[model samples]
Target: MKANPGSAAGSPTPVVEAKPCGNTGETVTERALRLRVRQQEILAELGVRALRGTPYPELLEYAVQCTAEGLEAEFCKVMEYVPAENRLLLRAGVGWEPHLVGTASVGADLASPAGFALRTGKPVISNHLENEERFRTPELLVEHGIRRAMNVILQGEGRPYGVLEVDSRSPGEFGEQDIAFLQGVANLLGMAIERQRIERDLRAMVEEREVLLREVNHRVKNSLQLVASMLSLQANATDKPDVRHELREAATRINAIGRAHQRLYRSNDVRVIDLAAYLVDLCADLNAAWPEGEVVARTPDEPVPIATDRAIPLALVVNELVTNATKYAYPGRQDGLVEVCLDQAPEESRVVLAVRDAGVGLPPGFAPHASTGLGMRIVTAFAQQLKAELRIRPLDVGTEFSLVISLQAPDRAG
Candidate 1:
């Protein structure tokens, strides 16, 4: 039986008995063992919640409530050290007035019990707060008529965060065994708080990098556009037909690259491109370039994500194939149809891009590898760079250029 601290002066201190586990009459040793087991169970539960990454505010609240219940104490709290003010803020707690929490402060100097624990990196227990001679009792405790208290330092990798303290108003002694349980709870809370800090820092770094990358893409696209415009002006100034034709072709290719960068600048993910959408946009540009002829794009409705590095080369290749068909496919006509198709190969890990025209066929027995034309040479170089297969089929009245590219895993941002 234990004496009630709230009993009046002239009346008998009412006795409270510890309940037995069963009707068999459990011994004192058995009761102590049961209490220890229950404490261990509570610690295990807190550990699991910490590992699962529970938010720090919720985790701290749970820790204090469970610690108080495990010790059968009346009050528990987690204090955050405010180095600037040299005090501890009541960050989370139970058994305190709602208004006091998050607004109350306690001394963090060696003269106070909690302060001594934080400074020495050791736990403090004062079973008799009224007659304690080593440290002065805090006014907050005195106001609540606390008879005993325990303090444990909460620390992580570097400096100490603060302290975890439990107080009791009832008449009881806080033993050495109680310190171990309280310290365990403080350790888990410290580690969890550190993890949250690291995660927040990493997320901020990633966001900053993404913003910088998007800015770089935007600048590159503008620079390429400027260069292409300069080339177009030079092509118009030249009097020689051959020089004019070559300069215009060079400008067209530069514009294609600029368009790819523009897409990256506008996209949410800078590492990859949507092949279907890129093809549709490219076809629109080609139609505007060759208003006399029509260029049609046929692609799957679903998005096909491709790495940014490969997307530029694929766009350039498509541009070259379509250009060739529009120039030489029809001998003397102004109106012709060129089709560009993108699809996945059936039952195979490959994608096929084909450009076909129905105006005229390739010269008899012509070989792409043996061709000396600058366009064919450019196509062959880019195809080798991509490690893709290039196939040309001669139709009855025109030609079809097909590029078979092996699909690769999507690239992830580091």
Candidate 2:
């Protein structure tokens, strides 16, 4: 083998001579064809691993090993370009000392073979590194007595990732065919690196958005609670019984919305609410708000997920029904029982929410649609938004307001 003295830098200058067939019956053409097929198979294997999302470090090591095996070379390495240090770190390699694999560094200037390939986005093959004048042999290669080396730039999105280099200790020449194999490995590695970077960035973005949403929910809860407190103060200062009752009712509705935001701020997932837990908490708050009447809630043991948009409206509907019952259910007596039940309906993808009170039943011939009460109108509008079926059934001694809400498919993006 002879060196090409006039070959330009960062070029795949072939200096290989065809070896004799020896005792085997195979011709030189047949051997070349077989080697080429084997190289293609190696690339296919690497491609499959890359697509499977192999771990970054494991993928790098595998790529270098396969590259060395494909070209039948003694050494191969993946160098990661460190822009700050202006050097290339030996990130992964085979046929190198364990201490040197992650610790060794090489010059990343045009004077070095690997650096020339990375800077020019070209392939470099130094069949005679010691006598090569276009680029200097790196000290690590000189220590290993590497006579021939091939370098290819690892192409990435918008920037070059690094360099892939294969070296040999034996007195053999690296040709154009070897450059093709090395470059193929480098391309696959670069693509995998880019994909990993994109996935990591997406995860970080999602985390940042969730943090901001939680902060917004917390602020909204605080503001709603402040308004409720102000309403309570105004009710206490009022002399008219009717005005006081109206202000207190308004405060209760505002409190219900505030509590929903409180739950969202505390939850890991801000997009959905746990209906069972929310109902129980809401009933507890209602009991505290109305000391004369006891509010009880029965819900499924497991969580029922409802989107935030539907949850707030459904919560308001419950608050209105409970408030109406507490005010009108018991006329003379102060002690009364109100029950709120929430569970999955027997029908598929449906939920049942029923608020009932053991008190004087609804007025005779009363029509919910014809009623001109503000609370009833509010309930009707929100029920329409929920697309729920609202049924009012008068029991022997109480009234039951039943709402059957159909659950939609959960949003996967959330």
Candidate 2 regions exceeding 4 Å error are 1-12, 15-26, 409-414
- Compare the candidates by lDDT and give the number of the best one: 2
lDDT of each: 0.85, 0.88
- For model 2 the TM-score comes to 0.90
- Itemize residue pairs with steric clashes in candidate 1: none
Kindly list the per-residue Cα lDDT of model 1 for residues 225-333, writing each as its tens digit. Answer: 8998899899889999989878877877887888888889888788998888888888888897788999999999999888888989988999898888888899899
Clashing residue pair totals per candidate (backbone < 3 A): 0, 0
- TM-score, model 1 to reference: 0.83
Worst 10 residues of 2 by lDDT: 1-10
> For model 1, how big is the CA root-mean-square deviation?
6.0
